[model samples]
Every structure is written in structure tokens, then in C-alpha cells.
Target: MHPSIPGTTPDTSSTTARSHPKHLKRFIIGSVAVLSITGLVAGGAFAVQSAADSRERVAATRALTDSTGLQRDQLGAYAGIAEAHTDKTASSTLAEANQVLASTEGKADASALTAVSSSLASFESMPIDLVVELTIETQTETAALSAAAAEADRVAAEAAAEAAAAAEAARQATLATTNTPAGAKAFAQSLASSNYGWGSDQFSCLNQLWQKESNWNYQAYNSSGATGIPQALPGSKMASAGNDWATNAATQVTWGLGYIKESRYGTPCAAWAHSQANNWY
Candidate 1:
């Protein structure tokens, strides 16, 4: 109203100035409340994040501890297996190998054992496989030696049997010549018939001839150094027939017959005729 402009109103300057102070105070209080609420929310968020991080750390530590325990258990299992292997080898194979070695000839006798003591004393230090191989080789050698010994014995037995048979043959060969005069004639008669295709007449002639000389005594000897039933001159000459020619009548008779045949007196009758004429044949 006091000189107002065309479209302007009058100002309440004093009233506005009085209300502005109250408004500015309220605004300042509200801003402080909002800032306190915001601070409380941020603090709660930080606490929750910290708790989650701590739980994550705890889970990671547990996982690492479990992994370490599993690794330790595996190592223990490997160690136990190695220990079992050592025990088994020591108890069974090693013991058996030692026992076998102890039974060997080189270790059996006290005197023989000393020769191999150095090796045997430290034999356990050798590897188990090597010990086992050596044991097998030794056993095989022992078996071979036993077989050789047995074979030698068998051969010796066979030779002894052959020698015995030869001796028996020599004894039987002289059986007829060792008989008494009457028995000699009977045996000669049988031999003449079977071997010489002669009859009793040839044996009778031979008996008479030998009776005049030695009476068929296998051990007959003469002052002229003659020996045996055939009275071979130079008694040692009968050795050509047999080493026992002096005692073996058949050996002497066989030699005498061979001599007669070579001298063209092929039969006992022929030898007797020649002997009768010359008193010796």
C-alpha cells in the first residue's frame, strides 16, 4: 500500500527472519540423526563381514589339518609294509637258508667248518635272494656227489661179482681133475662122450695114463719139477692155464689137452698111446 509497484506485494521481512533460525536448527538435528543411523548400519555390516572371514579362516585351517593327517597315515602304512617284508624274510627264508648252509660238508665237521668260517660268519649280510640261490646250488651239488658215490659203489659191486664169477669158473673147470682115480675115470668118460664125441674107451685110456703119472691128483708134484695132475715139467709152466693151475686139476688137464692137440695127439687115446710109448707126453 505504501507506494506499491504495479503487481508487487508488500514483504514480511521480520517474520521470515525469525522462522529461519528454527528451521536451520531442525535441519541440523535431523542431519545428525541420519548420520548416527548410517554409522550404526555400517558398524553392523563390518561386524558380520569380520565374522564370516574368521569362519572361512577356521574352515581352511581344518582342511589343511585333515590333509596333513591323511598324509601321515599313508606314510605309516608304507613303513609298516616294509617292516613286515623284512620280518618275513628274516624268519622263514633266511632261517632256512642258514640251516641248509650249516648242514653242508664245509660246515658240518668242526675242522672243516673253520675253512669256511670267514664266509659263513658274515653270510647273513648277503642279500636274501643271493643267499637262496647259493643254497639251491649247494644242494644240487650235494645231490650230484651222492649220485656219483652211489654209481661208484654200483660199479665196484659189479666188478667184485665178475671177479667172483671168474674164480668160481676156475674152480669148476678143475673139478674133474681133483677127483679120485675112480671118480676121475667116470668124469673123463662123461666129458669124452659129450665134448670130444668119444666113448668110454678113450676115457679108460686117459685114466690109465694119468693114474700111472699122478692118479689125477690136482696137487700132484714130481721130482723132475713137474706139477699138477698132468705133471707139467717146470711146474710154473702151468701158470699159462691159470694162476691156480697147481691146485686146479681141470686147468692142468685143459693145458695138457691143448699141448696134446698141438703135438698131433688130438685125443685122450692118442695122448695115452704116446705117453705109454715114451713114459711122458
Candidate 2:
């Protein structure tokens, strides 16, 4: 109005100021969008980290649980053996038993660890539990032999024991005998220490057969055609004990025991019956 211009008007300054308001609004929108994207990215990273931590915790828990289970099983077995002491504390057998307890306390596979638990002193203890069980049922049968021993007859005891030993030797001599290796007898004893259920019937039957088979000889062997302690018809079968099945009692015992467990369910009487029926154990 003061100086009327053809192209410009008094309202031009107002329009320019309004344009600044729109630009300010656009800037605010862009800042908000950037902030939203940043927040989303941070939240996603946090979620991933939390998930990884949770998985790690889960794995740790599983490992702890497995270790605890093995420890408990081994502990219970050791406790059972510790409760049943029949000999002097200083006996080598007792020492080996203690060693077995100590060895089994650590983490390891059960079967492989069987060889690390015992010593030669514990070999006789292997059949102690088994003998106890058998004596209960078949004590009458051994009564003549026991009576013979008690009558000032170390001769009878020796003869009977020798006979039993001979039978074992015979059996072992024929088949793939115990394949555990001589050094492993102690280890087997450790496992035997845990075997609270081993019985006399098993002992008697085993004695009767194995004495005739291997004469208590761990390394005794029959001809290749004859095969291990129980003398399986085919020598090849004793390989279940080890590749050197023909020479090892551990391998033989493992396989023979498996057969008894599977076919006879560890009943020595059943094994005896089968032996009687088949003429081959």
C-alpha cells in the first residue's frame, strides 16, 4: 500500500513465514523417524543377546544334570559295596575294592571304566557274592564237599577247590576265555563289588562248567574247534569279548554272561539246565 508494486504484495512476507513452518514440521518428522529406527535396532540387538544367553544357560543346565546323574549312580553303588565288608580292612581285596570306589567316582563311561577298578587281590572276590547265592540253594550238593573239608581235611577243601578251578580252566581253555586281560581282573572285581545280586547258583554252575572247561585257568584254551570257558561250539562267537577273544577271560566272561543274561537271564540254574540239555555251554 505504501508503494504499490505490480508483481509483489503486502502478504508476501506472511507467505514466507508460513513456508518456514512447513519446513520445520518436515524436519521434526524426519527426526522422529530416525529415532524410531534407532530404537527398533537397539531392541532387536537386546532380544538376540538375551536369547543366546538363555540357550547357554540351558546347555549348562543339561551338562550339570548329566554329571549329577552319573555321580549319583556311582555313589549309590559304592555305598552298597562299602556297607558289605566281610574281610579285614587291610586285605588286598579290600584295598582293591576301595580303589574301585575311588576310580569310579570320576566321570567316565561305565563299561570301559570296569577295567580300572580292581587288582589281582580282588579276583577271588569276583565269585564271593555268586557263591553266597549258590550256597543257599545248592549248599546241600556241596555239603559232602564242605563236610569233607571240615574233617581235618585241607585235602578235601583243596580237592574240591581244585576241581572247581579245573572246571573253570577247562571251560576257559576251550572257548574265548575272559578277554578283559589279566590286568583287568581287578577292574572286573570293582564291578563285581557293585554286584550285590551275584549269587551262589551262578557260582556253582559257573564252577562246574568252567572248572571242566579251563581248570580255573584264565589263559587256558581248548583247540580252536573247541572254543572259551563255557566252550561255545564255534570259536568265532567268543570274539564278542574282544578281537583276541581266543585268549582273554574278560571277553569270554562278557560274552558268556551276556548269553546267560539274554538266554538264561543270569540264572545259573537255567544255565546249568541248558548246559545239561545241550551238552555245550
Candidate 3:
């Protein structure tokens, strides 16, 4: 049982009631589209962030690998030097670095890789410094050994030179004691008897022959360029007997006796007879 109102339409109530479901449906659809777009945007941002992180990780890992390779090469070089020099400290340091590098293998995180790379770089310097120290020590020892060897050689040379000088001095002292005129004549007499089988008569003739020529003086020099007890025409001729011909009476007597024995006379007595006739013999 309804009653009529004024002229405000009853159709308005029905139309308004019907439009609410349409408006509500449109609002629901618009809200669903906005939520879908927001989700897509959020998902895209997450994917972009994930890809960037992967690139960073890859870059870091590559850097770590390259650095590790360089470190390994350096480590190998240092190990060789250490082994050659027998440096225990440097070898130990390299071993520790090797363990650290081994620990970093297969790591993939960016932060972890960068950290390990830094640690490795720092570790490399320690072994290098140790190797340098070892090299310096080895060089120092080598130089010291060389210096000691040179000193030893110098001392040995001086000792040898001193010994030679002492021997020469002893020879000169002996010559001074036994090279007088009387000593020269006695030596000649003994040599003539023993070597030439000449008797006292031969020695007496040899003595007279030499006395006339140079008076048995070992240092005798003649104006005819003759010298020594033998009075050879050239003083250098006496070098056949001994290097000390100018000063040694025994050398001069030996040469003179040989000349008398081997000459055309072949005997001291014959040589004396010839000298007595001529001024020179």
C-alpha cells in the first residue's frame, strides 16, 4: 500500500539505486589495474637490482682472479729466489701467502672477493721484502769472501818474495866469505887435481899462469874488454859457467880450468909455457 508523493519522480529512486552497482564495479576494476601496474613496476625494479648485483659480483670475481694470477707469478719468482739462496724466512712467508690465496679460491661474493684481493696485495710485499733482504745478505757474504781471498793471496805473495830474498842474501853472504884471492887459488888447485887428474906440478903451473894474468882476482877487468878470473875476451862469456861469474871465484876458476884442458894446449903446464912466451894467453 503505497501513496503518491509530489512531482519529484519515483523513477529517480530506481535509477539511483541501479547506478551504484555500475560505479562500484568500475572502481573495483580501476583498483585492480592500478595494483597490477604497481606489482609489475616493483618486480621490474627488483630484477634490475638483481642483475646489477650479479654484474658487480662478476666484476669483483674477475678482478680477484686476475690479481691472484699475478700474485701467483710473483710468488713463483720469489720462491725460486728463496730456494736458491736458502732463505728460510722468505720461504716461510711465501708459504703463508700461498695458504691465504688457497683460502680465497671459489669465492663469488663482491665484498668477499674485494677483501681477499686487498689482503693478497698486502701479503705479496712481505715476501718481496724478505727476498730483497736475502739478496743483500748473500751479496755481503760473497764480497767478504772475495776480500778475504784477496788478502790471503797478498800475504802469500809477500811471504814468497821474502823467502826468495832471504835465499839470495844467504848466497851472497856465503860468497863473501869464500871468494878471496887465497880462496880462489886453493879452489883452483883442488879442482885441477880432482877433475882434471892433474898433479901438484900442474897446479903450480896453473897458479903461475893466473897470477900473471889477473892475480886470481874474481873482479879482474882488462882494457881489452876481458873480465873475471878467467879473463875471457868478453865478460859475458863467463855466463856459461855461472850467472855470478863477475863476483864468484869458483865460477871463474871452473871456466879457466875448462879452457886450459880443452884448448890446443890441453894442459895447464903447456898453457903456462905459451903465456910465458906471449904477453896474452
Task: Give the clash count for each candidate.
Answer: 1, 53, 0
- lDDT of model number 3: 0.60
| TM-scores of the models, in the order given | 0.43, 0.30, 0.48
**Model 3 clash tally?**
0
lDDT of 2 by residue, 1-281 (tens): 23433332222122222223322221111111101110122212321223333344345434543755634235334434532432232243334444444544432223322333223234334433332333332323233333433453565677899999999889666443334333333333333334425555455665665556655455565666666655665767877667866666666666665666667445555667766888655
Worst 10-residue lDDT window, candidate 1: 30-39
Error of 3 at 1 (Å): 85
TM match of model 3 to true structure: 0.48
Best by TM-score: 3
Best by lDDT: 3
**Candidate 3 residue-wise lDDT, 1-281, digit = tens:** 12323421112122221223332221111111111110122212321223333344345434544755634335335445544454454345444434433553333223332343344333333434434454444444334444554666688799999999999999887677548888888888888889999999998888888888888888889998998887898988878888988889899899889988888989999999998998678
In the order shown, what is each candidate's alpha-carbon RMSD?
33.1, 33.4, 27.4
**Where's the lowest-lDDT run of ten residues in candidate 3?**
30-39
* Candidate 2 off by > 4 Å: 1-196, 218-224, 264-266
**Candidate 3 at 74: error in angstroms?**
6.6
